[model samples]
Target: MNPCFFYLLPSLLLIGFAFQSFGEAYETKPLACVLVEEIGGGGSSIPRTIRQTPVELHLIDPLNLIPEAPITSSPETLHLHVTDPSGKLLSPRLSSCEVTYLLPQEVPLAWVRSLTEEKRSPRALGHPWYSLSVKDDASGNTVSAVLGPQGEEDDKLTVFLAVYSTSATLYARLGDPLYVPCGFWRGQQFRSAIEWRHRALGDGKVLYAYDGRLDRIEEIFPGYEMNFSTLQSQGNASLLVDKVAVSDHGTFLCTIYLPYIRAQRDMQLEVTALPTVTFLPNPLFARPNEEITLSCEASHFHPLEISVELLRRLPGDSQFSVLPGVSLSTHTLNKDGTFSLTASLSIIASPEHHGARYFCRVRHISVPEGVTRSNTLHVAGVAGLSLEDGMYLFAVALALYGSLTFLHRKFKLVIGIHESKKDE
Candidate 1:
């Protein structure tokens, strides 16, 4: 064989081996290239800026997120596997890829999960810079890409993590003030429109709306004056419900539209009702030993946190005493969602109890410091007369009899005298 043939043969064999390995590598996509493409950078003269799609992350109500026990840094696992434009999974050795997470200041660093913890693969670039790196394998494969900007970023790929809708339940008296809050997490006061609607009637009645700029609140529905000045600065555009009425008890919806992103919150408002009290057996009359019951009825009230008490006040007493035998019966639910309660107090008629004022008192949580009272019941003595009154009646009867006899005798005498005169 010629000397040149030997050299040429070895070179050809090496080239064939290299081409075969390269073909095998193409069969399985490289994870690093996928990451680079996703992060708006691909090693090419013409940069391929992937159009960053806005992500809508619906979160639970922050108010309800308070952990019952001490909080610890436990990141939720995300089974993330990058894919190519053709929807093919990259290499399983994504372990060799370097990953960086860019987040807005609104989101906490603790909220992010570290993907490297599993096999000690990906590494983060330390505080303030959420950059993670995956070490290259012995075969020399590595991944390097930045997902989003590091800090103070307002560019595309801005993750929108917010509470889609905050659910809240509030109670107020029929005439008390009501405040419903629209919670916008962090300072995400993007350009948006605020709308408040009453969904209770299923008509979606508009209560208020602030257009493109929150310069002033326009009361779409009359009789509502809402304030939204702090919306731009604090992201809290709360609705102020003044002099809440029973008709206002229902579901309310608050909507914030940022053109690209839309959010909503729901609130259930319950307007508490005050009871109307009526007394049964008004102006009660009974014999000395008769048993009588006085009932206090409280009707048309809400949230059944009600109680009825029977009380008695003496003629000269400054304070009334609660009757021991007073009892409260189960409340009845009315068709209008209001409740009715009845309380009764039993009494054995006596002179002392007679002329005593009795009434039923209704108390409820809605009325913090006030109570409703039924009509006063004035107790009359036996047969509308006491023993003393009967004695007086007897004495008056005797005197009337004596006077009648005297008048009769005088009349007879006068008649006799008149007859004699006539005869003369």
Candidate 2:
């Protein structure tokens, strides 16, 4: 023997021992296995033999088996094992096995390589099939089985992995612009359509639809807009609402349709409208010892639950206190789907109430910190004559006195002229 052969002999033996041990270990216990038998094919009547041993075939990372995409940059090894029906190691190992690639009718099997470990790049349009044929050494029996895309032979498995994510909640303030995001992978040269539906309305109303052209249902969903140019270039099918309303609060469904493929995603929208708080008849004036009613209203708010507090701040106090005898009205629904409420405070006006400030503090889901509107009270005396009214009366009396004095002087002058004329 040559010196080189002697030097490489140990390495070769070690490699062979490692491979044999790996095969034995794989056959002894497989992660999973399925028993399969060959059926008649090619218009021939062939008797099928049920094999006891199960074949274990695994496609690691099946998600990467997308058509037109390279299976991997590097070669991927396929691990196969033969085990008995009881999941025990077989007595005699398989003598030979063949792995075949069954291509679609359009693509010939000769174009792809037939190897246990190879980089496979399938055609863009069709499904590639795999088959394993094994022969037991002891019984001289052969078994062949077709491995998955898990359907009938005639059914095409269109692999679709969503490129976008959903199930997130979005918040929008009332009357503000809102954008609902949805995206998908646009296949090459395929006809596609996008539809947006509101699931909260219970009618599944179509807010927007596009099929090579924009379909605007203006009567049902006004103020909704979409850009087809962006959708085509960026695969973005987001819906834009010019103004979000209370009716828009709910789950929305976006569906994308392609040839033999339909993808859908759901999103939630929460619309909040802050309450509009104001006091009715501000700068109120009341007479002492008289009963008066102060009204504060909160309007155009979303949801039915709200809090309206009537607060009072004495003339000298810095902090406000909740006013007594405050009554709240029932929530009134508006045509626009918002709610309104009125809070009233009744009190007997006295001198002590002069220069007091009353506040209407409103709290709602939209504004947790609350909003307050206040009005100042002006209490008049028992006669109900305010300072401005007394000033007005004094000015009127002064003007009357001046006019009477001028008229009296003119009358005296006229009498003197009449007496002089008579004496002459």
Model 2 agreement with the true structure over 1-424: per-residue lDDT tens digits: 7899989999999998876764554333223333344544545576565543433342222223222223232223333422122121232354354544443222111111121113343343255444444445565443333332434333232223132333256778888998888766544634556677897856567787655422332223678877667777877778888898888889877766543334466678878888888896665777776788889889999867888888889878998898777888898998888889999978777888787888888888899789988877777653366675567568889999999999999999999999999999
Candidate 2, pairs of clashing residues: none
Model 1 misplaced regions, further than 4 Å: 1-76, 79-167, 183-189, 201-204, 213-219, 278-285, 289-293, 304-363, 368-424
Query: Distance (Å) between predicted and true CA of 195, model 1?
Result: 2.1
Best by lDDT: 2
Per-model clash counts, in order, read: 3, 0
Residue 307, model 1: lDDT of 74
Per-residue lDDT tens digits for candidate 1, residues 193-245, read 66788876665677887664434444467556656567656566678876776
RMSD of each: 24.9, 19.3
All candidates: TM-score: 0.42, 0.51
Native RMSD of candidate 2 (Å): 19.3
Q: State, as a TM-score between 0 and 1, how close model 1 is to the true structure.
A: 0.42
